[model samples]
Target: MSRFTIPVCHVDDIDHESSKGFEIGDLNFFAVKRDGIITLFQNNCPHLGVNLEFQQDQFLDADNFYIMCSTHGALFQPEDGKCVYGPCQGQSLISVDFEVIEQQIHIAEAATAIA
Candidate 1:
């Protein structure tokens, strides 16, 4: 597997119920904070590769633990980007490696190529 690091957000910039999403290189990344941990996921919904941004950063459910794809109501866990509902079953959002330093997000070269 190609390993890449993305500098995403600051340690103090995110909290539960809130998230930061952005495009790295060839892929969309959603950085979410929950239980004091940060997780990253590719923004493409497996159902059709449509960007989760289609709904204007409204990717989280009201509970804020998973990514909700408004395109077809597919819910995904922020920890692993696994699909919990909708057309794509048993599939998951691609997880990307990332790090947070000085409140900036850096996408590793390999990660950027995917975006």
Candidate 2:
């Protein structure tokens, strides 16, 4: 399959300890920064398959420690996208392959299949 890079944003544009939303084709995703590392995941919450953000580009909890699901309060580890609490428990967010080049966030081409 042919692959393309979807530029999400500049590294500096994302707050030091927060997340921002992006899209490629019809896929919705988000990028998060924590402890100087950036990670990417599909926006859908594992528990309900709904958007994780309660408000626009707001994925982290008040403390900016974990990704909080808007609907059920699920907390996902920023490093591994694992749900540490809430309804999803052992479940994890779906990670999307991404890379930083020239200080720009670029996601791998959207996959044809979801699962």
Candidate 3:
């Protein structure tokens, strides 16, 4: 098993109250920044296991209050990825643990290097 720390982007890259998706190697993820807090989550919807974006970097709801699922219209909280409304109510998005070093978000991952 090998562990790696990958830098995703600068905090300023992700606009406040918005989200942007990124592909780190083979994994897909998205980041949401609200009120100076950054939250990262895998691009998997809890209900149908679908990507949670209507379009590019457009993960928030119409009012930009919650994370919305493109397919089913599910809404999730930005801080903790909790599904506040829609089909997957009470369920939550899978959160990716990350660190902010000098204003850059870096995610730590463990993967088996392919031989």
Candidate 4:
């Protein structure tokens, strides 16, 4: 598959680097890191299909370890992209592949897995 490299942001700019919102090609992406591992998820919540980053850092929980869906109060773990609470309990957030190079997050590949 032809993967497009979409730039997100600088590492230093992110407070937690794990749970943060990113934008690329008019689309928003979310990232989370736990135990030194990083995972990316689309900003939209599955239940309402609404972008979770709409409010000021609402995507992040008080601990800043998981991505929370502000629309329905869904809690998602960034480790495996699983939603542990809310309407989409059994569903998972869509994963967005990315790589950090030179301290910048880039969309390493488009979500070809979806198709």
Q: Which of the numbered candidates is closest to the native, going by highest TM-score?
A: 2
Once fitted onto the true fold, the runs of candidate 4 whose alpha carbons sit more than 4 angstroms away are 1-4, 109-115
lDDT for every model?
Answer: 0.73, 0.85, 0.84, 0.71
Cα lDDT of model 4 by residue, 1-115, tens digit: 3254656777655555446766655556766766666677777788988888646545777777667887778988778778898999989988887778777777764452342
Off by over 4 Å in 1: 1-6, 101-106
Local error of candidate 1 at 66, Å?
2.2
Candidate number of the best lDDT: 2
Writing each residue's lDDT as its tens digit, candidate 2 over 1-115 gives: 2143767789988899999987667778888999899998888998888999988999999999999998989999999999999989999998888777778877666441443
Q: Return the lDDT, model 1, position 58.
A: 65
List residue ranges in candidate 2 displaced over 4 A: 1-4, 112-115
Least well predicted 10-residue stretch by lDDT in candidate 1 = 1-10
Better candidate number, 2 or 4, judged by lDDT: 2
Q: What TM-score, over all chains together, does every model reach?
A: 0.80, 0.90, 0.89, 0.77
Number of colliding residue pairs in each model: 9, 0, 0, 2
The alpha-carbon RMSD values of the candidates against the true structure, listed in the order shown, are 3.2, 2.3, 3.5, 3.4
Q: Order the candidates by lDDT, highest first — what do you get?
A: 2, 3, 1, 4
Candidate 4 colliding pairs = 18-32, 18-33
